[model samples]
Target: MAEQTLKEKTAKGLFWGSINGGIQQILNVVFGIFLARLLSPGDYGLIGMLGIFMGVATVLQDSGFSTALINRKGIKHEDYNSVFWFSFSVGLICYVILFFCAPLIADFFGHPELTNLSRVLFLWFLIGSTSIAHSAMMTKKLMVKERTKIEVSAMIASGIVGVVLAYKGYAYWGIAIQTVTNAFVGAVLRWYYVKWRPTFTFALRPLKEMCSFGVKILFTSIFAQINANIFAVLLGRFYKEDQVGYYTQGNKWMNMGYTFIWGMIGNVSLPVLSEVALDVKRQRQVFRKMLRFVSFISFPAMFGLALVAPELIVIGVSDKWLPCVPVMQLLCIWGAVTPINNLYIHVLLSQGKSNIYLYNTIALGVVQLLVVVSMLSLGIYYMVLAFVVVNVLWIFIWHYFVNKYVEISILDVAKDILSFCLISLIVLCITYFVTKLIFNIYMLFIAKVLLATFLYTFVMYLSGSVTFKESFTFLLKRK
Candidate 1:
C-alpha cells in the first residue's frame, strides 16, 4: 500500500469519523429509549454510582500506553507487545482487587446488590486491556474505517443485549452486561483487523521507554476520569438513587450531542496534528480549521438539545423522566464547550507537552471536586450549575496554554468560534419562542429541531462560512 499524503489521510479519517459518530449516536438514541423505558431510575443510578471507580480502573489498565504508542516516532512489534502484556497484567491485578473490594463499595452505597454488580461491571476494563495495542496501531496508521466498523458493530451488538435483558427485567445487570459485551466485541474485532500478533518476547526496555511519556498521560487520564465521574460519586453518596438516576439520564443525553461533534473532530485531530507537530504554521492552520468546525456543530447541536430536552425526554422515555430535563439542559452547555478544551489538550499532547496536560487537568479536577463537594448541601442542581460555569470559564485557561504553545491567541480562537456560538444561540432562542405555542411535545421538539437547523444553516451560508461550505463540498465530493 502506498503511504497516504497528509491531506488524503485527513480527509479519509474525517469521512469515516463522521459516519462513525453519526451512526453511533443514532443507535444509542434508539437503544436508550427502549432501555430507559424498561428500566427504573434506580437501575441506571446503580450503574452510574460505580462510574468513577470503573473510569479510574480503565485509566490504570491502559496506563497511558495507547497515547504513548501514538506519540512515539518509531514503532516496533516489541513496543506493541510490551504494551499489550503490561496492560493485561495491570487489568488483571486491578480487577482482582476490585472484585474483592466490591463489598466495601456496596457497603458505602448501602446497596448490597452492588457487590455482585461491581464484580461483573469491572470486566469491561479487563476486556478493554487486550485491545490497547491494536487500537493504538490502528489509530497511528489512520485506519479509521476499520475502527469505525469495530465500534459501531460493538455498539449494535451490545444494544441488542441490553434491550433484551432490560425487557426481561434484568435492570442494572443488563446495563453491565451490555457494557462488557461491547468491550469484548471491540477487542475481538480490533485483534482481527490489526494483524500484529504478540510473541513470547516479554521485554522491559520498551515498556520503560514508553512509560516516561505514558505515565504522565496515565495520571492525566485518571484525574480527568475522576473529574468527570466525581458527580456520580458525590450524588451516590449524598443523594438517593433516584436523584442520581435523574442526573445520569440528563448527562447521558447531553453527552450524546457533544460526543457526536467531538467524535468527528477527535478521531482525526490527534493523529493529524501529531504528523505536523514540528511545523508551527501548519499546525496553527490545521488547529484553527478544526476549531471552527467543532464550534460550528457543537454550539448549535448542544444548545438545540437543551432547547428540546423537555420535549425529547417526555416523548422518548415518558413523563417520569421529566425531572432529568433541567439537569440535561445545564449539562448540554458543558457539553458544548468540552471539545474546545479537548482540542487544546490534544494539541499540547502532539507537541509532547504531556506535563502541561497533566498539570492543568489535575488543577481543574481538584478545584471542581472541591466546589461540587461544598455545594452538596445546596442541591444537585446547584452543583451541576457550578460545574457548567467552571467549564465555560476554563476555555480561556485552555486557550492560554494553547496560545503559549502554538501562538494561537485567545482573540484568534474567539473570532473563529464565537460567531457560530452567538448565531446558534440566537437561532435556538427564536425556534423555542416560535414553537412555544405548540401543544404537542413531539411536534414542538420536531419543529424546534427543524427550525434551528434551517436557520443555522441559512445564516452560515449567508455569512460566508468557509467551514460550512467546505464541509458540504467535502461530503458531496465523497458521495
Candidate 2:
C-alpha cells in the first residue's frame, strides 16, 4: 500500500469524520426524540445521576494509556500489550469497587433504584477497556474511514435496541442497554479492523514508561469528567430527579451539536498535527485552518440550536421537554466555543505538553466547580449561566498555553475565527426576527433553521470567505 500524502489523508479523514458525526447525531436525534417522548424526565435523571461514577470509572479504566500510545514515539507491541492488560485490569478493579459501592452511590443520591442501575450501567466501561488499544491504534494511524464505518454501524444497532426496549416499557434499562451495546459492538469492530493481538507478555517496564506521561493525562481526564458530570451529581442530590432530567436532556442535545463540528476536528487534528509537531511554521498553519473551519460550523450550528431550542423541544419530543429549553439555550453558547478549546488541547498533547494540559484543566475545573456550587441558591439557570461564562472565557487560558508552546497567539486565533462567529450570530439574529412571528411550531422550527443556514451560506459566499470557498472546492475536487 502506498503512503498517503498528509493533505490527502486529512481531506479523506475529514470527509468520513463529517459523515460519521453528522449521521451519528441524526440517529441520536431520532432515538432521542422517541426515547424522550416514551420515557419520563425522572427516567433520564436516574441515568444522569449515575454519570459521574461511570465517567470517572471510564477515565480510570483507560488510565490515559491510549493517549500515551498516541503521543509516544516509535510505539511498540509491548506498549499496546501493556496498556491492554493494564486497562483490562483497571476495568475489573473499577467495576468491582463500583459494584460494591453501588449502594453507597444510591445512598448518596437517595435513590434505592440506582443501586442496581449503577451496577448494570457501569459495565460499558469494562466493555470499553477491552478496545482502548485497538481504538488508539486506529486513531494513531488516522484510520478515519474504518473508524467512521464502525461508529455508524454501532449507532444503528444500538439505536434500534434502545428504541425497542423503550417502546416496550423497559424505561432507563433501555438507555443503559443501548450504551452497553454500543460499546460492545464498537470494541468488536475495532478489534476486527486493527488485527493487532496482545501477546502473553506482561511487562511493567512499558507500563511504567507510558505512565510517566499517562499519569498527568489520567489526572486531567478525571478532573475533566468530574467537571462535566458535577451537575448531575448536584442536581441528583440537591434537587429532584426531574430537574436532573431536564438538564440531561438539554445537555444531550447540546453535546450532539458540538460533537458534530468536533467530529471532523478531533479525528484528524491530533494525528495530523503530531506529524508536524516539530515544524512550528507548518503546525501553526494547520492549526489556524482547523480553527477557522471549526468556527465556521460551530458558531452557526450551536447558536441556531439555541434559536430553535423552544420549537425543537416542543415539536421534537412534545411539550413535556419544554423546561429543558432555557437550559439548552444556555448550554448552546458554551458548546459553540468548546471545539476551540478541544483543538488547542490536542495541539498541546501532540507536542507532549501533557502537564500544561493537566494544569489548565484542573484550574479551570476547580474554579468552575466552585462557581457553579456557590450559585446553587440561584438555581439551575444561574448555574448554567455561570457555566457558559466561565467556559467561553477559558479559551484565553487554552490559547495562552498554545501561544507559549506553538507560538499561535490569542490574536491570531481570534482573527481566524472571530469573523465567522460574528457573521453566524448576525445570521441567527436575522433569522430569529424573521421567524419570530410564525405561530406554528413546526413551520417556525423548519423556517428558522433553513433561513439561518441559507443566509449564513449566502453571506459567506458573497464575502468570498476563504474557508467557505476552500470547503466547496474540496468537495467538488473530491467528486
For model 1, the superposed segments whose C-alpha errors exceed 4 Å read 1-4
What TM-score against the true fold does each predicted structure earn?
A: 0.98, 0.98
Give the 10-residue window scoring lowest on summed lDDT in candidate 1: 1-10
Off by over 4 Å in 2: 1-4
- Displacement of residue 246 (Cα, Å) in model 1 is 0.7
Local distance difference test values of all predictions, in order: 0.90, 0.91
- CA RMSD, predictions in order: 1.5, 1.5
Clash list (residue pairs), candidate 2: none
- Top candidate on lDDT is 2
* Residues 1-479 of candidate 2: C-alpha lDDT, one tens digit per residue: 21248878888889888988999899999999999999999999999999988999999988788988888889899989999999999999999999999999888889999998888899999999999999999989999889988999999999999999999999999999999999999999998999999988899998888887899999999999999998999999999999999999999999999888899879889888898898888889889988998999899999999998998898889998999999999999999999999999999998899999999999999999999999999999999999889999999888888898789777888799999999998999999888989998889989998999899999999999999998999899978
**Cα RMSD for predicted model 1:** 1.5
- Tens digit of per-residue lDDT, candidate 1, span 400-440: 88888799877889898999999998998899788889998
